[model samples]
Target: MGKTLVIDLEDVILEGDILDVGEKNFGIIYNISKEAEDELSLDYVSSDTKIELKERKYDACTFFFDLNKIWTSIEKEKLIKEISSYLKEFGEIFIWDINKERGKVFNNKIKVILPNEKIKEFTFRNLNVLLSSNIEEIKKILEKYFEIEETKAWEDVFFIKGKKIGTKVNEEEKIKYEGTDYSN
Candidate 1:
């Protein structure tokens, strides 16, 4: 039986580059439904490391603050392995990246989970292309652990919060990401 995997991700994406290291706002939750499994449990083994950073902008004379910068890093391969291993025993896997905080500038960094698997050279365009065109490749890799349909999996991976909060599963929604271009 296939299980539904729900991933709640945070600033998991770095702007501009598309592919780079990603950080978690909190622990990723892998939720499976009753039709697939009765119970699910996961513990993040990575230690929490925090680093505080302050930056000042010229002209405007604005200062940036990151007081809760708990620096967290996990081996991309290891994270995938651990997650995949656990997912393999379930059904559909849902990956959700959410920007919990509302108004913090440069506050989204949740898409870095791929860097752990040696997947470099990422840009928003390519990532969106992969999401649309190369979904099978991603699905196969994901299938190694979970049972999810290619199309449906997209819903589980993307999230946005605003007046019109929703997933950017199409080309139009993805275009907005191009503005940043990973310089951050």
Candidate 2:
């Protein structure tokens, strides 16, 4: 059964479902323009690539400038799965990552101002592009847990928004994969 997870929910969330909105987290806590990246960099993830859930329900989540930083396709897929568990039924999710093709063009045009007060040409390569994928790949993974509603692009960045569908099929898959032990 190579088919992916399904978002079916019986005791799940719908548009009018009563969802408890927890203490909202504004994921973007830093303003890069107000600080130097070299002085205060915190984008690094630890050895565990797991996206742990908070002890509260959320109606919406966002991956503002961090999606591509996940270094592996498997890890990114895992992240999508983890996020799927964090939201209520019919919750919304938003993602923004730099487009691979357009990011190249955008990166090449970046000019850094030197300490000597002169601008020098530099190609930072999307500041560190790790998993730069197209819209198709994104839709494929998102469709596992959501019915993708919209997608848009702005220069080098792409955005996708979708609503959580259900969890019945996914729940069954989990149970199936976690079969009871039989030392056969």
Candidate 3:
């Protein structure tokens, strides 16, 4: 099962270069799924690690903002839920979120906001991030829509992968991720 998962993820590539350590936005995906019986979980690995993935083909449709930077959390959650409805069962969603442990990076950040017809450069880190992409909070929401595979963090960003959990599975059920270069 471990080898199978490694084979399955050999083709995932994100927007940022995973190999570049300086690029804090991306990191290698790990197989953190627990064993049904007695299998081991594969945490995210790197080149210096015991195992390394060689091939990568990212089928990603990256959308950073739903409406804008100033949207409320309620609106964001609503949009995520709506989007979740359209996805096929067993489909996966990869998300990049701000890392709370890396909060120091935002210490000097500021933004412009409009409140009561007055413009003010204020708000939490200028991003007004809801829950600061908190993993537990994200889990609370995503768990309703997906069977979370794993959650991991890098320097300034954290990544989560979730597989849609359907009520039933059909032998013909299939979902494929398509990147910009995908060709049938």
Deviation of model 3 at 68, angstroms: 10
Local lDDT at 51 for model 3: 30
* Model 2: lowest-lDDT 10 consecutive positions: 1-10
- lDDT, candidate 2, 101-153, per-residue tens: 32332243423233324334323234553346566677788898888998876
Give candidate 1 regions above 4 Å deviation: 1-23, 26-42, 47-78, 97-137, 150-184
Candidate 3, position 63, lDDT: 23
Query: What tens digits encode model 1's per-residue C-alpha lDDT throughout 72-118?
Result: 22232243334332222122233333211222222222233332232
Give the winner by TM-score: 2 or 3.
Answer: 2
Candidate 1, position 179, lDDT: 75
Clashing pairs in 2: 7-166, 7-167, 8-166, 8-167, 8-168, 9-167
Instruction: Give candidate 1's total backbone clashes.
Output: 30
* Tens-digit lDDT track of model 3 for 75-164: 656755654544444556666454442222232222222222322222223234342444555667777767778887544444567766
Higher-ranked by TM-score: 1 or 3: 3
lDDT of 2 at 40: 37
